[model samples]
Structure formats: structure tokens, C-alpha cells
Target chain A: MIETFRRVLRRLGSVETTSVLIVLCAVIALLGIFLPIRTSNWMVLPFALLMANLLAALATNARLKSQSMLFAFHAALVAVIVLVGLDRLHAMHGRVEVAEGSMFDASAVAAEHGLLHDLRLGEVRFLQGPFEITYAPGMKRRETESVIRIPEQNGGWREVRVGDHTPLIFGDYRFYTTHNKGFAPIVTYVSASGDSRTGAIHMPSYPMNENKQGLAWTPPGATKPLKVWLHIPEPVFDEAKAWKFVKPTNTRLVLIDGDERHELSVGEVVSLGSAQLRYDGLRSWMGYTIVGQSMIHWIAAASLMACLALLGHVLSVLIYGSRIPAAGAEHGG
Target chain B: MALEPAPRRRRRSHLIAAALVLVVIVAAGVVLEKMPGSGPTVATAPQQSASSGVTPFGQAFAKGIEAMRLGDAHTAARAFDEARAINPHIPEAHVNLGFAFLAMQRPREAATAFDRALSIDAKQINAYYGLGAALDASGDRKGAIGAMRTFVHLSDKKDPFQRKAMSALWEWEAAENGATPQQGEADAKSKPEAAAAKDAAAGETTASIEQQGGAGTGAKPEAVATKDTAAAEAPAPSEQKGEAGAKAESTAVAMLDTARRNNAPVPPPLPAIADMPDALTPPEGVISIVNVWASWCGPCRAELPSLQAFAAALDPSRYRLVGLNVDRDRDFAREFIRDTAVSFGNFWDGRGVFAKARFQVEAYPQTLFLDSSGAVIARVSGTREWPADAAEATVAEILASGQKKEPK
Candidate 1:
């Protein structure tokens, strides 16, 4: 058994055995492209068996004077194959869908924005077909004023579809839509006592202007001149109040402690006493997007690149060895 | 020294081979690592409100469109309502719902639906058309004309539907505006003949009218009214001649004016005949796999090799693979097939008949696997790996089974 093992080890380090292994690896690589790795696992057993046979064939070959580089190359190939197998076995993947006009953060929105929390959501609504459903995250329930009926398309309802770039995040999971808009409403609250405030609010607020006719009322008067401006454009504005409507402006506002005023923009948020306000800018209603990648995939990719580079170097040396010129007839021919 | 050099060369060859193998192994490993897995598993929660489903309003809208096309007005309305319930901001649902109402002949409800759609999306063309139709059905010709005029203003003149709609709007406007005392007297004198002629013309004009509001164009109403009146005065055969004569005279005059203005070629009259081949039926008794593909689909291009191999390996007597090219340009499809050296039968499906009616395929490289009886058995809608052995096995299994017919 010891002799047989030695013979196999010697064969594994032979040129013919290496050539067979090369063919085997090529075939496996080609197969990997076409078939799911899970279903293609059956091919791996045969490949291993073939590898063993090649090693056995190499054991009987005459020992070359130098074998370090060849052995290193073979070892590298084995290492890559083993690592890939492990990666395929352990990899994990999934998808997420995000709605339009919604925001999602896995960490504290406050830490990043220098507000209070890692993530902050304004107002969120779901647009299915004719039905509109508004959701308040704090309440964890639907709001009565949120449901709105929309027009249909082609005698049916219009749908918001998502793709990779367009994602709708509810909580942690994100949904992407094929088509998305880059507009969001900015809600600013002004206290009654003339205290000005600004921040990003989710839903459309009463229109604000110098006259403040369209603006929503400030908390019952304490006198610092207060108003709440909802900056997002409504799909259907009241015809009578049409003149007051303005295109959603990037400018956002928030009143801190009903005293200090801060203007926020996209990717910024303001802090009010006990309540954190974020200016989540407007984005188009895109659907869910699923990202299917794992750490193992990255590791495998890096290893493969290294192997390819090493292979190229080895090939160059073999094709242009110094002995070729010496073996040929002298120029005096 | 020679012996040592020989050994070195042998070692080098071994290294090269081993290195190649290593590269292959590493490449496979890297690809496996980079291979994107199925997207994150959607957290399956307990049954929640319908709104909680991540289904977008767009998909619901598409469903509503499908229901409407099937002539299920009630279902279409329900779908629209569901879509609106999900996203009230989309204007398509209201317009489609109004269309459904119009189909059900509920003019008031239809008008309201159109109003709602317009309120959401002022530029929506269908809403205006539905509004006009509802008004016309309710005998409010003036309101209908106003709506139709808006539709015409928003439509492109070169579009076939737009041209047809313009003609209808013009005729309707003309008939309403051209109520001369003489025409009224004549109509009163021969009400029966006039009514009969109007009935005959209605059939020919309905499609044009429906198309008109959607394609908005401001066509001259006077000429259209004259044509309508003439059609009402004559019998069906005589009406055709009168209409043809009027069209020729008007078209000739328009052409002359156009030529003089720009020194350009005279434009052709209406009903420009298109040079396209009539639809051909696939061979009988063979399962025709119609693959709708564009040259742009990477998956489609990748799968071509496998498909070609399958085609080469298959018994042509048992199956037929037909590629229905849905490209905007026919030459592109031809060139692609030629460059790829694909040996499968190909045809242009420019009319989008198969796409619209049978499969409703929205994505490219969609394959509809048909049974020998010419019924669709299965569909592979996206790019996928086709293992030769597995495919052959599936084909054999399909052949062996007695259940060859697909359920309609």
C-alpha cells in the first residue's frame, strides 16, 4: 500500500498527469457556467476520481531533475478548486424590495446624520392600483387620511414596477422598480409663536408661501410666527388651490425644540427635542431589488485571479525554454 | 549538461500544464464566488393585509390591462380598484376604470372615471378619449367634440391611430357644425333613407372615432361632415363611390399645395398599403418552439449555442424550433442570425400578434414550448442553462407521455 501511494504521488507530479488535469479543469469550468452548482455537484465526484487516476499515471513516470515549479502550480490549482467547492457549499443569497417615496436604514440614522437614530422614515404609502394606502411607521398602522383612489390604465390600475436600481425599502428589505423618480416631499413645521422650523417630512404638507394661505396651521398661537410647509407635489391638487402649488423644492426645514430652525436637504436630517427629523428626499416609486452575493464569492474570485496570473507565467516559460535553440542545428547549416 | 537541460525542459512543460489547470480551477472558483445567488429571501410573515405584499401597483395595473383586453369589464374594474387601493397616485387605473365603465355603457360612471384620471394625470390621452365617448353616448355632442379636440391636440398626426381619430373627430365636428337649412330639410324629407345611410357609415366610422380621441389631431370638420351627409344620402355601393371621389379630390388638392409650398414630393393619400407578407402557419404535427428574442439579450445569445446544438442533435421530424424575432429592424435580426451562424428557422413577428395574444411576453429570450398538437405546453420565460443530457431526458419523457394536449 505504501509503494502504491508513493507511485501515485510521483505520477501526480508528471507532465501527462498534469495535461489530463488541465482538460478536466477546463471541462469543469465550462460546466460551471452553464449549470447551477447545486445540481452540478454530481460532476465533482467524477472529476475527483479522474484526478486520482491522473496522479496514479504520473507516479510511474521518470523523475525529472527539477519539479518544484510544477509541484507549486499543481498545489495552487488544488487549493483553488477546494476553496471554490467550500464557497459554493456555504454561500448565502437573497433579495429585497423597496417601495417608492420610502426610506430604509439598517443602522441608526441619527449617528450618521448626527441626529438621534440610525434610520429615520418620513411618511410612506403603497400604490397598488386604484387604492392608495398610507402607512405611519411610528404608529405601526395605516392612517385614515392615507387611502386615496387613483385612476386606472387601459381599463385597469397603473402599477409601480421595480428593478435593480430602483428599490423600495420598507424596513430592512428593499424592493427595486424598473423606473424610479428622484423626487421626495420635504415637510417643515413652523411653531405658532413665529418660531420657524424645517426638516424632511414624508407626506405632502400644506403649501407654504409668504402669505401661508396653503400652509397648515402652526400649533395654537404662542407668538413666534409658525407654519408647517409640505413641499412635495400632490398627484391631484385641489383646483381652487392650484395657484399656490409649487414644484417640490430641494430646500427642507425643521424647528428644533420649537425654537431653533434648521434647513435640511437630501441626505440630511434635523434634530428636534426628543423627536428626530430627517429630510428624506423624494425618490420615484421603484419596486424591490434583490442582491444575491456572499463573502465566499469574493474570496474565490481573488484566488482565481492569482491562479490565472501564475498559469500565464508558467506557459510563457514552457513555450520559450532555452534548450530549444541548442537542440536546433547550428547556423552553419 | 545536456541531460540536465532535458530534465529542465520536461519540468517546465509539466509546470505549464499544471499552471493551466490551476488557472482553470481558480477561474471556476472565482466565477462561483462571483455568481450571484437567488435574491434575498423575502421574509415570509404571517398573512397580513393585501397592501403589505410587496407587489407594486405596476403589476396590478398590468393585470387590469389584461382583464380589460379579455372584455371582462367587471374584473377589469376590480383590478383597477385593487391597483388604486395600492397606489392612488397612478393615473392609469382611473383611465382604465373609466374605459371599463364606458364598455359597460354606464356613461355617468365612465365620465366620472375619466374625470378622476384627468385629475391625476392631465396628459393621459385615454382619459380624454373615454370622456369624449361617454359624452357622445350621453348625447352631449359639444362636450364630446371639446374632449376630442383636446385628444387631437395631444396626438401625433403621423400615427395611424391618430390619423384615423382625427378623421372621426373632424367628421363628428363637421356633422354637428354643418347643419344647414337645406341639409335639415332634405333629412326631414327623406328621414328613412338618411337614417339607413347613417347606420351604414357608423360601422365604418366607429373604429376611426375610437382611435381619434387617443391620437388627437385637428382635422377639418367641414369635409368630414360632407362625407357623412353624402354617405347618409346614398346606398352602400353608391356611398363608397362618392366617398372615394371626395377623398381623391381633397387629397389631390392637398398634395398640390404641399408640393408648391416646399417643392417636395407629393405625399400619398390615406390608406397607404404596407408591403408585408401575410402570416404563415407553422408545419403541422411538429411541436413548434417559438422563441421571441432580441439581439440585445445576453442570455438569449448565450443560450443560442446550446439551442443550436439541440437543434442539430434532434430529429427534425419530431420537433421544430422557430425563432420569432421581435426586433424593430428586420435586417438586424437577419444579420445577427447570419453572424452567429444559427441554423434555426426564423420569422419576423412585427405585428406582435404572438406576443400580444398568446404569450403576452414582456421579456426577451422567452421561449414558448409547444406540444406536437400546436398548443403551448410550457414556457421558459427567461435565460436559463440548457443541459443537453437533461433536456434530452425531458424531451424523451414528454414524448413518452400520452398527455400531449395542452389545456386551453
Candidate 2:
């Protein structure tokens, strides 16, 4: 039985096993990408098997004394794979867009966590500051600048620049700027019960749904829906490129129920027959692509080591290995 | 023996070195684990509670339809919504809700309603048509194509919406250039029937069209994403070092930009412009609309073609229309113009420095209207339906005014 187990290990660590696993991994990855399979599920098995194979190769194959470079390369490859596994176990990628001047919170984020991920994002705290963009004469956007405000230990919000190239790192999550940013209209809906609730209405994507600026909003406690749009005389998109992000000032919320449409500007109220709505000023939202991964540095280091060791291995074989063989030939002669 | 001993020594040394390297790699990973930037603290946050969305259906739904037939979408929405409150699972209710939402210009909600309708009853073929129209109007071109393709698939050629669905599918298919053209191939290979039915080849001829005269040239909208299309949207150069997770996540995150989304080709970023025009004034005796726009602006991109088309229809003798280009890269702007076939004169709005300083040109694609005397008459901010339904009548009216002499 022991001998059989040894044979199994031998086969498992063999190059043929590695090749098969690689091909399987490729196939699985392709299916995950083009098909409906969740990539994490498809990848885990091959990766786990690869890890075992790599460890077996290290244990049974290495000579344990001389070619440091070749050894380092294999070691680095192992580290990279292991680190990647850990990353997969705990990593997550999600997104959150905070309305400007609003606090970033858990409820605002839409996240999908990994299988083993313990989300500790409750501590992640930041407020969105004002953002700016620049455009050339021909109306091509040139630059984008957004600032994120974090509460300082001293009780003030410290600001940091975040843009297309700059990401905000808070609580192990890296927030990158994506191209999805737009307007949010703040309005207070007064129910028939005389209770008013205020909320933000995020418009459909700008310039994309620019012509159609309303969403169907069924106010809390109200059975009937109202079509609401922040009808700015012109959306404050003029501030960009000459570009600073801004809510369109003096914009009115046009509430439509059937053919009955009434406009209400800031601090003004429009009656919804049984209930009323107040136009609270408009606000803007900047979209962010959020990511959390474990051991980024370890993975990066392992990759660097792998490259260097491969180069060293190549040189040693080409330049030094040739010397030893020639020297042996001379001695034989 | 001497030569053999030396080769053996080298091999042994190499193995030992490899073992040591392994130790070091492990140690480095440990060190990284201890670092602040590596991982999040292990704290289990409570998951957000799921909504109990199942409502029962009854009388109020029927009540809402009366307002609907009278062309009062508001009433229809209320009635359908009431029916929804009682029972949320009915696909038919959602379909009517979608229509009511569309009537009220609430395309996103209409889309949500249609999507909900489909989720409940996948066989609700009309929901696909509603989804297509809503997605298309909402500027979700890729989503619109997918929904339309499904509509075309499930719909008979004689269906009223079938031809329109085909037209929309063809337009987006060309725009996407077969972004999802290989669903059947990938599915046939991988056997994910449900996903394949939804993904790949907005124009693939996998499913045979129902036998009828004048079915659209067989272009089907495929699923939300494919690996090839995902790769196409991914950031270049980084992709070489990128893992499978990053590639998939990038596509997913990009799609999540909107509720349901697709990626369009992005114009490369460029340097800021050097100059800003001093005035966005109109020429004398010509009523004008100085449309300020940037290349990066999504709405501006969609609106420009319509503006160009509108300009083409107008008599140049009475209309002075100018596009204010605020793109930083002049060359890219020219490329965009050429690609979009924009013929009108466009001036640079460098950083919008001049416009902001002169006029309160705060929004993108803002149309500043001017009467014949080059005097600014009005500022149309936000998004405008350039011609609205009155494009022809409006243009004719403007031409007549331009021709008439003012009372002395």
C-alpha cells in the first residue's frame, strides 16, 4: 500500500501531470470567460492541483545544493502561484459611487465577495470632494481631477487627489476612477400622511439618456408612481473641461403623473394631488471601480524573481555550462 | 571520475540552492502578509437583508388600466403598480407597467419592469420587445441589441415589433462589429445553453428565423459579454501581466457601470487645448444654436449625429449653427468629427475657460440660442430633443422668421 502511494505521488508530480493540468486549466478558464461558469469555481481545482504538483516537483526533483539561479526561478514561480491562490480565496472586486459631499458607507456599495472573503469594509470611510475635468477647444476631454476627503485623526477631513490614473486606497480597498459619473437630484416626497422623506434620484447615464432624464419613482407609502427628472435649464456639464463637476443650479424637478407635469425649483413645492414633493438642490456623483486583493506585493515580487531567475538560468546554461563541457573535453584528450 | 564528481557537485549545489530559494520566497510572502497594504482585517460584516419582493395580485391592477386606455400613463402606472403591490410575480402586470413607464419617459424603470417580467416568465415574448425599446432609448446600445436579438428570436415575423427590433439590432450590430458574434460557437463548444442564448453574435445565424416573409436579415443579439469582446474592452499592455480574475473582473466592473451595460470603443486621452474662443456669438441675420460639447461626453456623442442630421436638413442661408468643441486633443477631435461625419464649423472651448468667464456655459452640449441679430436669446441647458417631434415645423418657422423683416 505504501509503495502504491509513492507511485501515485510520482505520477502526480510528473511533467505529464503538469501539462495535463495546464491544458485543463486553459480549457476551464476559456469556459469561464465565454460561458456561464463562475471563474473562481473553474479555476480553483486546477490551481489547487497545480500547487500540489509544484510542491511535489520541488520536493522530489530539486538537488538541494548548486544552481541558485534555477532554484530561485522555480521558488518564485511557486510563491506566485501560492499568493494567487490566497488572493483568489480572499479577494473581491466591487464598485461604489458616492454622491458629492455625501459620506461613503456600506449601504451605498454594491459588492460581490470571494468565497472566503471576510468583508471588513465597514471601517472604510471617506467623503467625496469636488471633481474637475478639462477639455480642449475641439471638445475632447483632456484631464480629470477628483478629490476624496478622508477624516484626519485631528478631526478634519484631509483631501487627496483621485482621478483616472489616481486611485484612493482605504481599508485595503483600491478605488479607481471609471468613466461612469453623472447627476443626482435630491427631492423630498411628502406623503398623504404628512410625512416627508428626502432621497436622491440618480438619472440614467448622461449624454446616453440625456433626452430622457426621468426615472419612475414610487414615493414611500404612495402606491402611485411619478416620473421625476431634475430639469436643469442646461445640465451643469458646462463646468467640465473648463471642467469642474457641478450640480445644475436652479434646476427644477419635473414630476409627471400621466399628462400632469409640474416643475418645482429648489426650496419650492409641487403638489402631487394627494401628496406633495419638494425640490431639494441637485448633487453630483462620481463613480468608482473598487478592488480588494491580498498579497499584491508578494505576487509582484515573485513575478520579478521569476523573470530574473529565468534570465540567469538561460545565461548560465548558454555561457557557463558551455565552459564546463569544453573543459571536460580538454581533460579527456 | 574527476569530471563526473564535478558535474554531480554542480547538480547537488543547484538543488540545495533551489530549496533555500523556496524558503526565502515563503519568507517574503510572510513579510508581505504582515504589511498594512496586503489584506483586510478579518471581520464579518452583516449581509444586507434581501427584499421580500413577492407581492400578491388582485383588483387594483385592473383599476389602473382604465387611466391607461385614456392615454394617461400615470393612471396606468398607478393601476399596474397596485396590482404589483399585491402579487409581484405576474409577468403580464410587469409588461403593462413597462408600457406605462415608457409613456411617462421612464425608460430605466420600463427596462427594470421588462427585466422583471422576463425573470418571472421567460416565455413572455413581448417583454423582450419592451426591454429592447427601453434599453435603446436609455442609451444602453449593447443591452438594447441583446434584448432585441432575443425579441427577434422569440417573435414571429408578423409581430408588430419584429421589424423595429431587427432595425435596431442591425444598427448596434454594426456599431459593436460582432462584439458578441460567437455565442453559438462558444456554447456549442462549452454547452452553456442559457448563457449562449443570451450572449454572443448579435448577428449570428444560429437560430433559424420563423418562416415568414420579410424577417430581418438574421442578426441575433447575443449575451452580455464574451471573452473576446471582454479582451477588446480591457486596458491594453496591462492585459499581458493580468490574470484571469482581472480580465473577467474588468469586464464585470465595466458592465456594472450602469445597471446593465456594454463597452463601446474609447477614444484615447490627449493633452489640453491651448486656446479658448473669446465669444460663442452667432452670425448676423441667422438664428443660431451654439452647441457646446466635448469628445468625452457620452450624451454629446449620441446627440451630435442627430444635430448633424438636423443641420443637413436646414437651409444654411437662414441658420448659423456652431458646435463648441471642448476636447483637449485637437487631432482626436478631428478624427471623431471625421468618423461621425460632422460638417458644421466647430470652435475650441479650451478648458471652457472663455465660455465660463463670458457666459454661464456650465453644462455639456448646452445649446445657446440666438435670434438673427447675434444676440443671445436663451440658454437651453440639460439635454434637449433638438428637433423634438416638431423638427420640421420648427425649422420652417425659423426660416420664415429669418426671411421676414422686423417692424420698424
Q: Largest lDDT belongs to which candidate?
A: 2
| Model 1 lDDT per residue over A135-195, tens place | 2433222321111111243343223323344343443233333221122343333342335
Residue by residue across A16-78, what tens digits does model 2's lDDT show? 788998898888877888877754454577778988877765544433123567557877788
Candidate 2 lDDT for residue B312? 70
- Candidate 2 residue lDDT tens string, B314-383: 6667666778777653544643553355677677766576556555676787766666554556565656
**Docking level for model 2:** incorrect
- What Cα-based lDDT does every candidate model obtain? 0.45, 0.58
Using DockQ as the measure, the top candidate is 2
Per residue, candidate 1 scores C-alpha lDDT tens digits across B169-244 of: 6656676988433445544544333222222222222233222221101112224344445455542543432232
User: How high is the lDDT of residue B166 in model 2?
Assistant: 71
DockQ per candidate, 2 decimals: 0.05, 0.07
Reference contacts preserved by each model: 0.08, 0.15
Per-residue lDDT for B177 in model 1? 81
Model 2: residues with Cα > 4 Å off, grouped in runs: A1-3, A62-68, A136-142, A152-154, A235-245, A322-333, B1-408
TM-score for each candidate, following the candidate numbering: 0.25, 0.47
